[model samples]
Structures are given as C-alpha cells and as structure tokens.
Target: MALLNDIDGLQKPDNHYILVLYPGAETYESLKNALAPLISDLIILKKRGFNQIGGYYWSVELYFSSDWKFLAICLGMKSANTLHFCPWCDCSKNEMNTTSKKINKSMDNIKVNYHKINGHTKEPLFHMILLHNWMFDELHILLRITDRLWELMLSDLRRENVNEEIWKEKILLEMKQLKISFQFWYKRNSNNLLHTSLMGPDKLKILRELDLTAIFQSRT
Candidate 1:
C-alpha cells in the first residue's frame, strides 16, 4: 500500500490505470487479507482531503488461465461451455462438432450466470470473465498444430521414389519454410509482444476466416 503513495505523482487525476496483483496459490489467502485493509484506507483517503478515487481497486476486472473449465470452477462460474450458464440470455452453443456451424447457429452471448447459495454459506463469489493465456492459447497450440501438419507433409514426401538423402534434405527445407511462415504470422503487423497481446475481437476475426470444419488429413 505504501508503494502506491509514489504512484500519485506519476499520473494525472482523470487518467485510468490498472493495478494488477498476482498472488500465487499459496500466498493468495494472505494477500487477500492484506489488500482488504489497504483498500479501506484508500477509501478513507478518498473521503478525506486526498483526491485519489479508489474505484479501480474496489472491483475485480478479469482472470486469466489456460484451462477455462478449471478457472471457471475457481471463480464459481458455471461452465461457459454450457448453455445454462447464462440466466437472463436465451442462447446456446450448438452440439455439432463443426466450429463454423456452432458459430453460425449460436447467438454468442457474453453474460455469465453467478452461483447462489443459502444454507450454511453466507455469500457466493464469482469472476466476471475468464480469459485464456496468450502463450498457451495461441503460440503453443499453433506450434503443435503446425508440427502435426509438417509430419503429415513429410509422410507424403516419403512415398516418393527419390533418394533417402534427398528426401531428408526436402524435410529440412520444409521445416524451415514452415518456421518462416509462423514467424511472419507471429510478427504480423508489429513486434512479438504486441502480436501475442491479441484480444478477443482480433482472435474471433481470424477464426472466422479459417475453414473451421476442415479435418486434418495427417495421421503422423
């Protein structure tokens, strides 16, 4: 909390800024305990002579994870993968395995249904949204899919009656070409960091351009 005292001088009054706190699993309990008191002080400061409006620290914004299902559970969110997760909205994901069909048939609702409890428990806590990590969702998965595609290409090349040494050279060249393509796409319009920071709208736009129903022909 004391560290934030220095922050006031650096930014203008109306400018909005996020203060992200990343407390690991084990320290989460302690961090929560400490943050409560600090926020209370900030609220008090706002009420006093200080002009620091503390609304930003008062509420949670977003949560990130590789596994949406597990993150949903931790945040007391009903699976986004299910239709029943939204209470007010009347929409659902189509059961068809085809991604394109599902996108077309479904209305794509963003509302989240919070879990409620009565009996022994007092209150229910839930996150507003669960975001996928950039590394896991984009880079890692794309690399894996590309690797599988390259293996398939190599298998096709193997069936040729060319010499084994020449075939190996062809595989190396193919690998280099694939790597170059991935690099170009990764750094599409900007540097690595900016490219990886692609948000939901951009990702969805790219997906809409793909042949979502196309099945991979490679077994390797």
Candidate 2:
C-alpha cells in the first residue's frame, strides 16, 4: 500500500491518500511495476508545478517513507543484515557502532556508480526522488527496537535457567492485565516460542504499562 500524506496539511489519519495497493509479494520488479504510474506523476509534478485555482502554481516536494525492509527493496539495496547494512551511508556492520562516520551517500553518487555502490544492489525504483528525502517510519523503528529488547529479555531469562512455561505464563498474564492481547505458541516442529505480532499502540502499552522489572523480580 502506498499512502500519500500532505506534510503541510492537517496531521490526521483522514488526511492521507492511498496512491497504490498491490496485493502481491514486494519484489523489486513487482514494486517498480506497481509504482510506475505514481513515479511518472511525481516526475511531472517535480518538473512542472501543479496549477491550482486563482492562477496559483504549487511546487511539490516528494518524501518517501516506509519500514526498513520495504525501503531497502524500493531503493534496490541489500538486506539490513549485509556487510554494508545502512541504506543512507556506506557504513559497514563494524562501523555502525561508531559515531565518527558521516553520511557520504547521495542520489547523484548512486546514479553515477549504480550497482558498484557498497550497499546498493540495483538501480533504485524511485530514482526521481533524492536519497535524503527517503525516510524511515518512526513507528516501525520503535517496533523493531521493542522486538530486539523482547528477544534479549527472553535470552536473559533462559540464561538464568528460568522455566519457559513459567515466564510465558507470567508474560501473558501481565499482557492481559494491561489490556494488550498477546500469546505464546510453538510451531509444528520447532520448540521456539512465537507470540502475537503487536501493533504500535500495543507495543507502547507493553513498554509503558507492562511491569517487566516486577516480573523479573518475582521469577522465583
């Protein structure tokens, strides 16, 4: 789904417009074909300003926003786990932890080098837009961070020899108390615990209302 939001307009759910909705798998070719019309429109809008009422001409500035995976796919970049993991920079996995590196990538550089770029795999689908205009959704970032923290917490519990059933039960009970629907289940052949995928609001509730410290303290 491609949602168009007016950044200068009202900040509400109703203000957003759906540009395209593709139900198939999100591959580079699929996305490129799906977004072709929208891309053409954007190119025209950028080149020729939109003419409104009363002889007014408004210039449009496009900003692409999505989760990391979708953004990587659209940009024709490698997956986040690759050696050069960052979409915005040439920073490798080793340099990601450092703070001294600067963002030296731009749309011009990517166009000039194409597949030769460290992180980029192919030509970007949205080549009309500048690289700096592409943004990562904040809500997705929060959810990803929450997932990592949850995984680390589970690892710590396992390290302390905490019973899996006990911890799972405690977590479900806490989630229920907080009015957040969560559960744990095992796959057909796997012993790993799979839980319900939480939305932004539910994840926020877990972060703020779910008492993790108390649960950890009470693991007897």
Candidate 3:
C-alpha cells in the first residue's frame, strides 16, 4: 500500500488541464508529435477495448477526473477505421473472408443510442477530427493505410536483411498514396559532444524519416 501511494503522489492533479486520451497496442504512437504538449502534461490515458474510430481515444478522455478540463481529440483521418471489421495478421492473409456486418450493424445501433442520451455536468467535451468534405466510404481506406504502415514498420525492425533504400521508398510511396507529405528538421544535441557518441553502433547509424504518428492520408 505504501509503494502504491508513493507512485500516486507523483501524479498530482493539475486543475484546469486539457485532457488528452490515447489507447495502447497499435494505437500508442499514432499521434506522437501533434500530441506532444498534452502527453507531456499526462492528464488521461486508457486502454480502449477494441478501438473505435470516433471514440478510440474516447475511453482515454473519460478517465480524466477534472471538471474544468477541455477534451480535444486528434481526430486524424485514419483513426476512424481502427474498430472496423478488418483482419491484418498472417493467419488471415491470402484467404477470402467477409467483414462482420453484424458487428457493424450492432455498433452503429450503440452509437445511435448513446447520441440520444447526452448531458453535460463537469468538463466540456470537444472533437478535433476533421469532418468537413470527408466521404463516408474513405473511412475504411484510412484505417487500412494505418494498418499497412504499422505492419511495414514492424516488419522492417524484425525481418532479416531489410533493404534500407527499398524500404524507405516503400514508406514514402505509402505516404504519397495517402496524399501525405513529410517535413524534415535537424537538431544539435549535447550528447553529440564527441561528434560520435551514439553512432558507434552499426545499425543505428541510419533510419527512415517518416513521421508515423503525424501521417495523414488525404483522400484520392
């Protein structure tokens, strides 16, 4: 009990905070740079049960206890299909299957039901997802793109003899297909004292520059 209390003390609540929510598993690193400020504060974090596009991080926002806090969702385009009926594993690949229509129908009913019973008491809620000029069908495409990127990144890390040039090209191509562009930046760190601090390692010398979290695939 004493140990738990000590850990709790480090998390002292700051009143009038902005609540930032995010789930675990594949969702952990999605909103990296865009969420740097809120993540630094460490307001609310939750592991959502089976991600939902509109409310994947809603579970995280709900964990906030502050009454005056404002809820801002990153609401990126690919975030919407995180909960849809798609399989992305080795077992399901190269096999013909259909989406879970029943699950789709059922979840829709729940969303509809929840939308009906709404009231505000403590903190005000806000959505950051861009809904303007968005098509209904593109939601699934966005999710697929995210899933593909996740799979590719993991593969690159684990697979043997991964081609750097080819893999980088693939990542860039994926970003291009999604209509996303990446910006580059450079920084000088104190750790580079010897100008050869961390580069002692062979593999760490090179890496892809794609921003996984900030990747936004505009509609084609």
Ranking according to lDDT, highest score first: 2, 1, 3
Local distance difference test values of all predictions, in order? 0.36, 0.82, 0.32
TM-score of 3: 0.20
Best-matching candidate per TM-score = 2
Over 20-89, each residue of candidate 2 has an lDDT whose tens digit, in order, gives: 8899888988888898998888888878978999999977677888999999998889888889878777
Stronger candidate by lDDT (2 vs 3): 2
True-vs-predicted CA distance for residue 192, candidate 1, Å: 35
**Tens digits of lDDT, candidate 3, 1-220:** 0112246463555423344455543222445544577544433232332356775533332222111111112221122223321211112222326453221212223223423322211111212211231123333444455556555654544354544344444545655654455322235663211111212121121224444443231110
Sort all candidates by TM-score, best to worst: 2, 1, 3
lDDT of 1 by residue, 122-181 (tens): 111222232221112354445455555545654564565555445444433433543322
Q: In lDDT terms, which candidate is top?
A: 2
Which residue pairs in candidate 1 collide? none
Candidate 1 root-mean-square deviation in Å: 13.3
- lDDT accuracy of residue 38 in candidate 3: 56
